[model samples]
Target chain A: MNITLKQAEKIIAVAKEKSIEIDTKMNIAVVDAGANLVAFARMDGAWLGSLDISIKKAKTARYFDMNTGIIGELSQPGGPLFNIEHSNNGLITFPGGVPIKNAAGEIIGAIGVSGSSVENDHTVAEAGALAI
Target chain B: MNITLKQAEKIIAVAKEKSIEIDTKMNIAVVDAGANLVAFARMDGAWLGSLDISIKKAKTARYFDMNTGIIGELSQPGGPLFNIEHSNNGLITFPGGVPIKNAAGEIIGAIGVSGSSVENDHTVAEAGALAI
Candidate 1:
Protein backbone atom coordinates (compact mmCIF):
# COMPACT_ATOMS: atom_id res chain seq x y z
CA MET A 1 0.00 0.00 0.00
CA ASN A 2 2.95 2.30 0.59
CA ILE A 3 6.32 2.76 -1.02
CA THR A 4 9.02 2.39 1.58
CA LEU A 5 12.11 4.56 1.52
CA LYS A 6 14.30 1.50 1.73
CA GLN A 7 13.22 0.36 -1.74
CA ALA A 8 14.14 3.68 -3.27
CA GLU A 9 17.62 3.59 -1.82
CA LYS A 10 18.08 0.13 -3.14
CA ILE A 11 17.12 1.19 -6.64
CA ILE A 12 19.54 4.09 -6.59
CA ALA A 13 22.38 2.04 -5.23
CA VAL A 14 21.88 -0.65 -7.80
CA ALA A 15 21.81 1.84 -10.64
CA LYS A 16 25.02 3.46 -9.51
CA GLU A 17 26.78 0.17 -9.04
CA LYS A 18 25.74 -1.13 -12.44
CA SER A 19 26.31 2.06 -14.29
CA ILE A 20 29.20 1.88 -16.75
CA GLU A 21 31.44 4.57 -18.20
CA ILE A 22 28.48 5.77 -20.17
CA ASP A 23 27.70 7.93 -17.16
CA THR A 24 24.14 7.81 -18.30
CA LYS A 25 21.74 9.97 -16.39
CA MET A 26 18.86 8.13 -14.74
CA ASN A 27 15.24 9.09 -14.17
CA ILE A 28 13.26 6.99 -11.72
CA ALA A 29 9.63 7.00 -10.58
CA VAL A 30 7.61 5.22 -7.88
CA VAL A 31 3.86 4.77 -7.63
CA ASP A 32 1.47 3.80 -4.84
CA ALA A 33 -1.17 1.09 -4.51
CA GLY A 34 -3.85 3.19 -6.14
CA ALA A 35 -1.65 3.77 -9.15
CA ASN A 36 -0.68 7.18 -7.86
CA LEU A 37 2.78 8.67 -7.70
CA VAL A 38 4.72 8.21 -4.50
CA ALA A 39 8.22 9.33 -5.44
CA PHE A 40 10.40 10.29 -8.38
CA ALA A 41 14.06 11.03 -9.11
CA ARG A 42 16.00 12.43 -12.03
CA MET A 43 19.76 12.22 -12.08
CA ASP A 44 21.68 15.30 -13.00
CA GLY A 45 22.20 15.64 -16.76
CA ALA A 46 19.42 13.19 -17.45
CA TRP A 47 17.32 13.89 -20.49
CA LEU A 48 14.41 16.20 -19.78
CA GLY A 49 12.14 14.23 -22.08
CA SER A 50 12.87 11.13 -20.05
CA LEU A 51 11.25 12.68 -17.01
CA ASP A 52 7.70 12.48 -18.31
CA ILE A 53 8.27 9.17 -20.09
CA SER A 54 9.74 7.61 -16.97
CA ILE A 55 6.76 8.53 -14.83
CA LYS A 56 4.32 7.38 -17.48
CA LYS A 57 6.07 4.00 -17.61
CA ALA A 58 5.51 3.49 -13.91
CA LYS A 59 1.87 4.36 -14.30
CA THR A 60 1.58 1.84 -17.09
CA ALA A 61 3.02 -0.85 -14.88
CA ARG A 62 0.85 0.00 -11.89
CA TYR A 63 -2.31 0.40 -13.95
CA PHE A 64 -1.76 -2.82 -15.85
CA ASP A 65 0.21 -4.71 -13.20
CA MET A 66 2.33 -6.10 -16.00
CA ASN A 67 5.58 -5.32 -17.80
CA THR A 68 5.49 -2.50 -20.35
CA GLY A 69 7.37 -4.58 -22.88
CA ILE A 70 4.46 -7.00 -23.00
CA ILE A 71 2.07 -4.17 -23.67
CA GLY A 72 4.06 -3.29 -26.77
CA GLU A 73 3.21 -6.63 -28.33
CA LEU A 74 -0.50 -6.10 -27.90
CA SER A 75 -0.39 -2.97 -30.07
CA GLN A 76 0.70 -4.72 -33.19
CA PRO A 77 -1.31 -5.88 -36.18
CA GLY A 78 -4.51 -7.69 -35.27
CA GLY A 79 -3.78 -6.64 -31.72
CA PRO A 80 -6.09 -4.45 -29.66
CA LEU A 81 -7.23 -1.06 -30.89
CA PHE A 82 -3.55 0.00 -30.85
CA ASN A 83 -4.34 3.45 -29.58
CA ILE A 84 -2.30 3.77 -26.39
CA GLU A 85 0.31 6.34 -27.51
CA HIS A 86 -1.98 8.59 -29.55
CA SER A 87 -4.84 8.63 -27.03
CA ASN A 88 -4.57 12.45 -26.83
CA ASN A 89 -4.16 11.86 -23.15
CA GLY A 90 -0.72 11.46 -21.52
CA LEU A 91 -0.59 7.70 -21.92
CA ILE A 92 2.63 6.17 -23.22
CA THR A 93 3.39 2.58 -24.26
CA PHE A 94 7.01 1.54 -24.21
CA PRO A 95 9.50 -0.66 -22.40
CA GLY A 96 11.77 -0.19 -19.35
CA GLY A 97 8.98 -0.14 -16.77
CA VAL A 98 8.37 -2.64 -13.92
CA PRO A 99 6.28 -3.28 -10.81
CA ILE A 100 7.13 -3.92 -7.17
CA LYS A 101 5.48 -6.56 -4.97
CA ASN A 102 5.51 -7.31 -1.26
CA ALA A 103 6.47 -10.57 0.39
CA ALA A 104 2.89 -11.75 0.05
CA GLY A 105 3.11 -11.07 -3.71
CA GLU A 106 0.75 -8.15 -3.46
CA ILE A 107 1.49 -5.27 -5.80
CA ILE A 108 2.11 -2.32 -3.54
CA GLY A 109 3.81 -0.04 -6.03
CA ALA A 110 6.08 0.19 -9.05
CA ILE A 111 9.37 1.67 -10.39
CA GLY A 112 10.30 3.25 -13.70
CA VAL A 113 13.67 4.47 -15.02
CA SER A 114 14.73 6.31 -18.14
CA GLY A 115 17.75 8.03 -19.78
CA SER A 116 19.35 4.85 -21.12
CA SER A 117 18.92 2.19 -23.73
CA VAL A 118 15.99 -0.12 -23.26
CA GLU A 119 18.31 -2.97 -22.31
CA ASN A 120 20.18 -0.86 -19.83
CA ASP A 121 16.96 0.49 -18.41
CA HIS A 122 15.61 -3.02 -17.90
CA THR A 123 18.84 -4.16 -16.33
CA VAL A 124 18.79 -1.37 -13.80
CA ALA A 125 15.13 -2.01 -13.04
CA GLU A 126 15.76 -5.74 -12.54
CA ALA A 127 18.58 -4.89 -10.19
CA GLY A 128 16.33 -2.59 -8.20
CA ALA A 129 13.63 -5.26 -7.91
CA LEU A 130 16.13 -7.84 -6.79
CA ALA A 131 17.60 -5.42 -4.29
CA ILE A 132 14.23 -5.11 -2.64
CA MET B 1 11.82 -3.32 -29.91
CA ASN B 2 8.75 -4.73 -31.55
CA ILE B 3 5.56 -6.18 -30.09
CA THR B 4 3.81 -8.73 -32.25
CA LEU B 5 0.06 -9.14 -32.71
CA LYS B 6 0.27 -12.77 -31.69
CA GLN B 7 1.22 -11.73 -28.17
CA ALA B 8 -1.85 -9.53 -27.80
CA GLU B 9 -4.17 -12.33 -28.79
CA LYS B 10 -2.56 -14.61 -26.28
CA ILE B 11 -3.02 -12.07 -23.49
CA ILE B 12 -6.71 -11.69 -24.28
CA ALA B 13 -7.19 -15.44 -24.46
CA VAL B 14 -5.56 -16.05 -21.13
CA ALA B 15 -7.59 -13.33 -19.47
CA LYS B 16 -10.83 -14.89 -20.67
CA GLU B 17 -9.75 -18.29 -19.43
CA LYS B 18 -8.83 -17.05 -15.97
CA SER B 19 -11.70 -14.65 -15.45
CA ILE B 20 -13.97 -15.67 -12.58
CA GLU B 21 -17.61 -14.95 -11.94
CA ILE B 22 -16.88 -11.28 -11.47
CA ASP B 23 -17.72 -10.65 -15.12
CA THR B 24 -15.30 -7.81 -14.95
CA LYS B 25 -14.63 -5.76 -18.02
CA MET B 26 -11.03 -5.32 -19.17
CA ASN B 27 -9.05 -2.50 -20.74
CA ILE B 28 -5.80 -3.47 -22.39
CA ALA B 29 -3.02 -1.36 -23.95
CA VAL B 30 0.07 -2.11 -25.97
CA VAL B 31 3.02 0.06 -26.91
CA ASP B 32 5.82 -0.06 -29.45
CA ALA B 33 9.58 0.54 -29.56
CA GLY B 34 9.34 4.31 -29.30
CA ALA B 35 7.04 4.07 -26.31
CA ASN B 36 4.18 5.15 -28.52
CA LEU B 37 0.69 3.67 -28.72
CA VAL B 38 0.32 0.65 -30.97
CA ALA B 39 -2.85 -1.15 -29.92
CA PHE B 40 -5.50 -0.93 -27.22
CA ALA B 41 -8.80 -2.53 -26.18
CA ARG B 42 -11.60 -1.93 -23.70
CA MET B 43 -14.22 -4.43 -22.71
CA ASP B 44 -17.90 -3.57 -23.04
CA GLY B 45 -18.49 -2.64 -19.41
CA ALA B 46 -15.07 -1.55 -18.31
CA TRP B 47 -14.52 1.54 -16.22
CA LEU B 48 -13.50 4.65 -18.11
CA GLY B 49 -11.01 5.68 -15.45
CA SER B 50 -8.84 2.71 -16.36
CA LEU B 51 -8.18 3.83 -19.91
CA ASP B 52 -5.72 6.66 -19.24
CA ILE B 53 -4.13 4.80 -16.36
CA SER B 54 -3.53 1.75 -18.51
CA ILE B 55 -1.65 3.59 -21.26
CA LYS B 56 0.27 5.72 -18.83
CA LYS B 57 1.45 2.55 -17.13
CA ALA B 58 2.80 1.31 -20.43
CA LYS B 59 4.64 4.58 -21.01
CA THR B 60 6.04 4.50 -17.51
CA ALA B 61 7.39 1.05 -18.15
CA ARG B 62 9.05 2.08 -21.37
CA TYR B 63 10.51 5.23 -19.93
CA PHE B 64 11.75 3.73 -16.70
CA ASP B 65 12.45 0.27 -17.91
CA MET B 66 11.26 -0.96 -14.52
CA ASN B 67 8.01 -1.88 -12.79
CA THR B 68 5.60 0.80 -11.57
CA GLY B 69 5.25 -0.86 -8.17
CA ILE B 70 8.90 -0.32 -7.42
CA ILE B 71 8.67 3.27 -8.53
CA GLY B 72 6.14 3.88 -5.77
CA GLU B 73 8.72 3.18 -3.12
CA LEU B 74 11.19 5.78 -4.30
CA SER B 75 8.59 8.52 -3.86
CA GLN B 76 8.27 8.08 -0.12
CA PRO B 77 10.18 9.68 2.73
CA GLY B 78 13.71 10.59 1.67
CA GLY B 79 13.09 8.74 -1.54
CA PRO B 80 12.88 10.53 -4.85
CA LEU B 81 10.94 13.75 -5.08
CA PHE B 82 7.78 11.66 -5.20
CA ASN B 83 6.36 14.04 -7.74
CA ILE B 84 5.48 11.64 -10.54
CA GLU B 85 1.73 11.60 -9.99
CA HIS B 86 1.75 15.33 -9.29
CA SER B 87 3.90 16.37 -12.20
CA ASN B 88 2.36 19.06 -14.37
CA ASN B 89 2.73 16.73 -17.33
CA GLY B 90 0.52 13.67 -17.60
CA LEU B 91 2.38 10.74 -16.05
CA ILE B 92 0.73 7.92 -14.14
CA THR B 93 2.28 5.71 -11.49
CA PHE B 94 0.39 2.64 -10.36
CA PRO B 95 0.10 -1.12 -10.66
CA GLY B 96 -1.46 -3.57 -13.19
CA GLY B 97 1.13 -2.81 -15.82
CA VAL B 98 3.81 -4.98 -17.51
CA PRO B 99 6.48 -5.05 -20.21
CA ILE B 100 7.22 -7.19 -23.27
CA LYS B 101 10.75 -8.19 -24.29
CA ASN B 102 12.18 -9.72 -27.37
CA ALA B 103 14.29 -12.89 -27.58
CA ALA B 104 17.41 -10.77 -27.29
CA GLY B 105 16.08 -9.39 -24.06
CA GLU B 106 15.48 -6.03 -25.68
CA ILE B 107 12.59 -3.99 -24.39
CA ILE B 108 10.18 -3.86 -27.29
CA GLY B 109 7.15 -2.36 -25.58
CA ALA B 110 4.66 -2.76 -22.75
CA ILE B 111 1.05 -3.67 -21.83
CA GLY B 112 -1.46 -2.21 -19.38
CA VAL B 113 -5.02 -3.10 -18.35
CA SER B 114 -7.69 -1.51 -16.20
CA GLY B 115 -11.40 -1.89 -15.34
CA SER B 116 -11.05 -4.32 -12.40
CA SER B 117 -9.72 -4.58 -8.89
CA VAL B 118 -5.97 -4.15 -8.56
CA GLU B 119 -5.61 -7.86 -8.09
CA ASN B 120 -7.84 -8.65 -11.00
CA ASP B 121 -6.13 -6.09 -13.16
CA HIS B 122 -2.78 -7.60 -12.35
CA THR B 123 -4.04 -11.09 -12.99
CA VAL B 124 -5.31 -10.16 -16.43
CA ALA B 125 -2.12 -8.31 -17.24
CA GLU B 126 -0.07 -11.24 -16.09
CA ALA B 127 -2.08 -13.56 -18.25
CA GLY B 128 -1.50 -11.32 -21.22
CA ALA B 129 2.23 -11.19 -20.60
CA LEU B 130 2.45 -14.94 -20.26
CA ALA B 131 0.43 -15.45 -23.41
CA ILE B 132 3.27 -13.90 -25.32
Candidate 2:
Protein backbone atom coordinates (compact mmCIF):
# COMPACT_ATOMS: atom_id res chain seq x y z
CA MET A 1 0.00 0.00 0.00
CA ASN A 2 1.07 3.53 -0.64
CA ILE A 3 1.86 5.88 2.24
CA THR A 4 -0.50 8.73 2.92
CA LEU A 5 0.47 12.35 3.54
CA LYS A 6 -0.62 12.08 7.17
CA GLN A 7 1.53 9.03 7.68
CA ALA A 8 4.41 10.73 6.00
CA GLU A 9 4.06 13.72 8.30
CA LYS A 10 4.04 11.45 11.30
CA ILE A 11 7.23 9.81 10.14
CA ILE A 12 8.85 13.19 9.66
CA ALA A 13 7.79 14.37 13.12
CA VAL A 14 9.26 11.29 14.75
CA ALA A 15 12.47 11.66 12.77
CA LYS A 16 12.76 15.38 13.48
CA GLU A 17 12.39 14.75 17.20
CA LYS A 18 15.12 12.13 17.07
CA SER A 19 17.42 14.53 15.26
CA ILE A 20 16.83 17.17 17.89
CA GLU A 21 17.32 14.67 20.66
CA ILE A 22 20.69 13.85 19.19
CA ASP A 23 21.54 17.55 19.09
CA THR A 24 21.88 17.50 15.32
CA LYS A 25 19.93 19.19 12.57
CA MET A 26 18.87 17.04 9.63
CA ASN A 27 17.24 17.02 6.25
CA ILE A 28 14.68 14.23 6.31
CA ALA A 29 12.58 12.88 3.48
CA VAL A 30 9.90 10.18 3.28
CA VAL A 31 8.86 8.47 0.09
CA ASP A 32 5.91 6.29 -0.82
CA ALA A 33 6.07 2.69 -1.98
CA GLY A 34 6.19 4.06 -5.50
CA ALA A 35 9.44 5.79 -4.71
CA ASN A 36 7.92 9.25 -4.89
CA LEU A 37 8.57 11.82 -2.20
CA VAL A 38 5.68 12.06 0.28
CA ALA A 39 7.01 14.42 2.91
CA PHE A 40 10.20 16.28 3.65
CA ALA A 41 11.68 18.46 6.37
CA ARG A 42 14.88 20.43 6.46
CA MET A 43 15.41 21.24 10.09
CA ASP A 44 16.46 24.77 10.90
CA GLY A 45 20.23 24.95 10.38
CA ALA A 46 20.39 21.65 8.56
CA TRP A 47 22.68 21.21 5.61
CA LEU A 48 21.21 22.76 2.50
CA GLY A 49 22.92 20.24 0.28
CA SER A 50 21.14 17.43 2.13
CA LEU A 51 17.80 18.44 0.63
CA ASP A 52 18.55 16.59 -2.57
CA ILE A 53 20.45 13.76 -0.89
CA SER A 54 17.73 12.98 1.65
CA ILE A 55 15.09 12.69 -1.03
CA LYS A 56 17.32 10.57 -3.23
CA LYS A 57 18.15 8.31 -0.32
CA ALA A 58 14.47 7.61 0.34
CA LYS A 59 13.85 6.86 -3.32
CA THR A 60 16.87 4.60 -3.52
CA ALA A 61 15.82 2.57 -0.48
CA ARG A 62 12.31 2.10 -1.79
CA TYR A 63 13.54 1.33 -5.29
CA PHE A 64 15.75 -1.54 -4.12
CA ASP A 65 14.02 -2.54 -0.89
CA MET A 66 17.38 -2.48 0.85
CA ASN A 67 19.52 -0.08 2.79
CA THR A 68 21.35 2.42 0.65
CA GLY A 69 24.52 1.59 2.52
CA ILE A 70 24.27 -2.03 1.40
CA ILE A 71 23.94 -0.84 -2.13
CA GLY A 72 27.04 1.26 -1.63
CA GLU A 73 28.96 -1.82 -0.56
CA LEU A 74 27.74 -3.79 -3.52
CA SER A 75 28.51 -0.92 -5.83
CA GLN A 76 32.13 -0.67 -4.85
CA PRO A 77 34.67 -0.55 -7.70
CA GLY A 78 34.68 -4.27 -8.42
CA GLY A 79 31.28 -5.19 -7.03
CA PRO A 80 28.33 -6.25 -9.19
CA LEU A 81 26.50 -3.00 -8.63
CA PHE A 82 29.35 -0.75 -9.61
CA ASN A 83 28.30 2.48 -11.25
CA ILE A 84 24.72 1.90 -10.11
CA GLU A 85 24.66 5.30 -8.44
CA HIS A 86 24.92 6.72 -11.94
CA SER A 87 21.50 5.28 -12.63
CA ASN A 88 18.10 6.49 -11.35
CA ASN A 89 19.02 10.15 -12.01
CA GLY A 90 21.42 9.95 -9.05
CA LEU A 91 21.14 7.59 -6.09
CA ILE A 92 22.92 8.18 -2.78
CA THR A 93 24.20 4.72 -1.91
CA PHE A 94 25.25 5.67 1.57
CA PRO A 95 24.00 5.23 5.11
CA GLY A 96 20.90 7.16 6.24
CA GLY A 97 18.43 5.60 3.83
CA VAL A 98 16.05 2.88 5.11
CA PRO A 99 12.91 1.17 3.88
CA ILE A 100 9.72 1.55 5.91
CA LYS A 101 7.77 -1.62 6.34
CA ASN A 102 4.21 -2.04 7.57
CA ALA A 103 3.16 -4.24 10.50
CA ALA A 104 2.87 -7.18 8.10
CA GLY A 105 6.54 -6.72 7.16
CA GLU A 106 5.64 -5.45 3.71
CA ILE A 107 7.59 -2.42 2.66
CA ILE A 108 5.25 0.55 2.49
CA GLY A 109 7.72 3.35 2.04
CA ALA A 110 11.17 4.57 2.97
CA ILE A 111 12.94 7.29 4.91
CA GLY A 112 16.22 9.14 4.42
CA VAL A 113 18.28 11.54 6.53
CA SER A 114 21.36 13.67 5.94
CA GLY A 115 23.31 16.45 7.67
CA SER A 116 25.28 14.70 10.39
CA SER A 117 27.64 11.79 9.89
CA VAL A 118 26.49 8.68 8.10
CA GLU A 119 26.14 6.92 11.41
CA ASN A 120 23.80 9.59 12.72
CA ASP A 121 21.97 9.78 9.42
CA HIS A 122 21.30 6.06 9.52
CA THR A 123 20.26 6.20 13.15
CA VAL A 124 17.74 8.96 12.52
CA ALA A 125 16.36 7.22 9.45
CA GLU A 126 16.00 3.92 11.29
CA ALA A 127 14.10 5.63 14.04
CA GLY A 128 11.71 7.13 11.51
CA ALA A 129 11.16 3.86 9.68
CA LEU A 130 9.96 2.29 12.92
CA ALA A 131 7.25 4.93 13.06
CA ILE A 132 5.46 3.42 10.08
CA MET B 1 12.00 29.43 5.99
CA ASN B 2 15.13 29.99 3.91
CA ILE B 3 17.85 32.53 3.51
CA THR B 4 16.60 35.98 2.64
CA LEU B 5 17.86 38.42 0.02
CA LYS B 6 19.09 40.77 2.70
CA GLN B 7 21.12 38.00 4.28
CA ALA B 8 22.37 36.85 0.92
CA GLU B 9 23.41 40.39 0.17
CA LYS B 10 25.37 40.43 3.39
CA ILE B 11 27.14 37.26 2.34
CA ILE B 12 27.99 38.80 -0.99
CA ALA B 13 29.28 41.83 0.80
CA VAL B 14 31.77 39.81 2.81
CA ALA B 15 32.77 37.77 -0.20
CA LYS B 16 33.29 40.86 -2.27
CA GLU B 17 35.43 42.28 0.47
CA LYS B 18 37.55 39.17 0.42
CA SER B 19 37.92 39.33 -3.33
CA ILE B 20 39.03 42.94 -3.16
CA GLU B 21 41.41 42.30 -0.31
CA ILE B 22 42.92 39.44 -2.26
CA ASP B 23 43.14 41.61 -5.39
CA THR B 24 41.12 39.14 -7.44
CA LYS B 25 38.13 39.59 -9.69
CA MET B 26 35.38 37.12 -8.87
CA ASN B 27 31.90 36.15 -9.86
CA ILE B 28 29.98 35.34 -6.72
CA ALA B 29 26.65 33.63 -6.29
CA VAL B 30 24.50 32.79 -3.27
CA VAL B 31 21.66 30.31 -3.05
CA ASP B 32 19.03 29.82 -0.36
CA ALA B 33 18.38 26.59 1.46
CA GLY B 34 16.01 25.50 -1.28
CA ALA B 35 18.94 25.73 -3.64
CA ASN B 36 17.32 28.65 -5.35
CA LEU B 37 19.40 31.58 -6.43
CA VAL B 38 19.03 34.46 -4.01
CA ALA B 39 21.72 37.01 -4.83
CA PHE B 40 24.77 37.29 -7.06
CA ALA B 41 27.43 39.74 -8.13
CA ARG B 42 30.08 39.78 -10.82
CA MET B 43 33.11 41.91 -10.07
CA ASP B 44 33.92 44.45 -12.73
CA GLY B 45 36.24 42.89 -15.34
CA ALA B 46 35.58 39.39 -14.04
CA TRP B 47 35.77 36.55 -16.57
CA LEU B 48 32.50 36.35 -18.45
CA GLY B 49 32.39 32.54 -18.38
CA SER B 50 32.72 32.37 -14.58
CA LEU B 51 29.22 33.58 -13.88
CA ASP B 52 27.75 30.15 -14.62
CA ILE B 53 30.61 28.41 -12.88
CA SER B 54 30.04 30.38 -9.70
CA ILE B 55 26.35 29.52 -9.63
CA LYS B 56 26.91 25.84 -10.36
CA LYS B 57 29.57 25.55 -7.70
CA ALA B 58 27.18 26.94 -5.08
CA LYS B 59 24.45 24.52 -6.15
CA THR B 60 26.86 21.60 -6.14
CA ALA B 61 28.04 22.34 -2.61
CA ARG B 62 24.42 22.44 -1.45
CA TYR B 63 23.55 19.26 -3.32
CA PHE B 64 25.94 16.99 -1.37
CA ASP B 65 26.80 18.88 1.82
CA MET B 66 30.50 18.64 1.06
CA ASN B 67 33.11 20.90 -0.42
CA THR B 68 33.12 20.82 -4.19
CA GLY B 69 36.80 19.92 -4.10
CA ILE B 70 36.06 16.90 -1.96
CA ILE B 71 33.48 15.82 -4.47
CA GLY B 72 36.14 16.28 -7.08
CA GLU B 73 38.43 13.89 -5.28
CA LEU B 74 35.67 11.34 -4.77
CA SER B 75 34.64 11.46 -8.40
CA GLN B 76 38.10 10.73 -9.64
CA PRO B 77 38.40 7.55 -11.68
CA GLY B 78 38.33 4.38 -9.52
CA GLY B 79 37.00 6.41 -6.57
CA PRO B 80 33.75 5.50 -4.82
CA LEU B 81 31.92 8.30 -6.62
CA PHE B 82 33.44 8.13 -10.03
CA ASN B 83 31.53 9.85 -12.79
CA ILE B 84 29.19 11.55 -10.33
CA GLU B 85 29.65 14.87 -12.03
CA HIS B 86 27.59 13.60 -14.96
CA SER B 87 24.59 12.94 -12.74
CA ASN B 88 23.48 16.32 -11.38
CA ASN B 89 23.18 18.09 -14.74
CA GLY B 90 26.71 19.40 -14.25
CA LEU B 91 28.67 19.89 -11.03
CA ILE B 92 31.92 21.78 -10.62
CA THR B 93 33.82 19.46 -8.31
CA PHE B 94 37.00 21.46 -8.06
CA PRO B 95 36.61 24.16 -5.40
CA GLY B 96 35.17 27.62 -4.71
CA GLY B 97 31.95 26.64 -2.97
CA VAL B 98 31.00 26.85 0.71
CA PRO B 99 27.82 26.34 2.73
CA ILE B 100 26.48 29.34 4.67
CA LYS B 101 25.37 28.64 8.20
CA ASN B 102 23.13 30.57 10.55
CA ALA B 103 23.83 31.28 14.22
CA ALA B 104 22.56 27.79 15.08
CA GLY B 105 25.21 26.29 12.80
CA GLU B 106 22.56 25.25 10.34
CA ILE B 107 23.37 25.51 6.65
CA ILE B 108 21.03 28.24 5.58
CA GLY B 109 22.48 28.50 2.09
CA ALA B 110 25.71 28.38 0.09
CA ILE B 111 28.13 30.70 -1.69
CA GLY B 112 30.21 30.11 -4.80
CA VAL B 113 32.94 32.21 -6.33
CA SER B 114 34.91 31.91 -9.53
CA GLY B 115 37.13 33.94 -11.93
CA SER B 116 40.35 33.33 -10.02
CA SER B 117 42.21 30.20 -8.96
CA VAL B 118 40.30 27.47 -7.11
CA GLU B 119 42.14 28.42 -3.96
CA ASN B 120 40.98 32.02 -4.09
CA ASP B 121 37.51 30.89 -5.06
CA HIS B 122 37.28 28.70 -1.98
CA THR B 123 38.66 31.36 0.34
CA VAL B 124 36.24 33.97 -0.86
CA ALA B 125 33.29 31.59 -0.65
CA GLU B 126 34.26 30.63 2.89
CA ALA B 127 34.43 34.26 3.88
CA GLY B 128 31.01 34.86 2.43
CA ALA B 129 29.53 31.84 4.20
CA LEU B 130 30.58 33.31 7.52
CA ALA B 131 28.46 36.40 6.93
CA ILE B 132 25.41 34.67 8.35
Which tens-of-lDDT digit does each residue in B1-132 have in candidate 2? 478899999999999999999999999999887778999999999999999999999998887666789888876645544544644566788999887888887777788899999999999999998877
| Clash totals in order | 87, 2
Error of 1 at B122 (Å): 19
Identify the leading candidate in terms of TM-score.
2
Query: Tens digit of lDDT per residue, candidate 1, span B84-109?
Result: 55542454445567777777788777
- In the range A1-132, model 2's lDDT, one tens digit per residue, is 778899899999999999999999999999999999888999976866667778888998999999988888887777899878888888888788999988889999999998887789999999999986
Q: Is the docking of candidate 2 incorrect, acceptable, medium or high quality?
A: acceptable
- Model 1 agreement with the true structure over A12-105: per-residue lDDT tens digits: 6776566444466778777766667777778878889999888887777776677777767764432332334433245456677787887778
Query: For candidate 2, what is the interface RMSD?
Result: 3.9
Q: Is the docking of candidate 1 incorrect, acceptable, medium or high quality?
A: incorrect
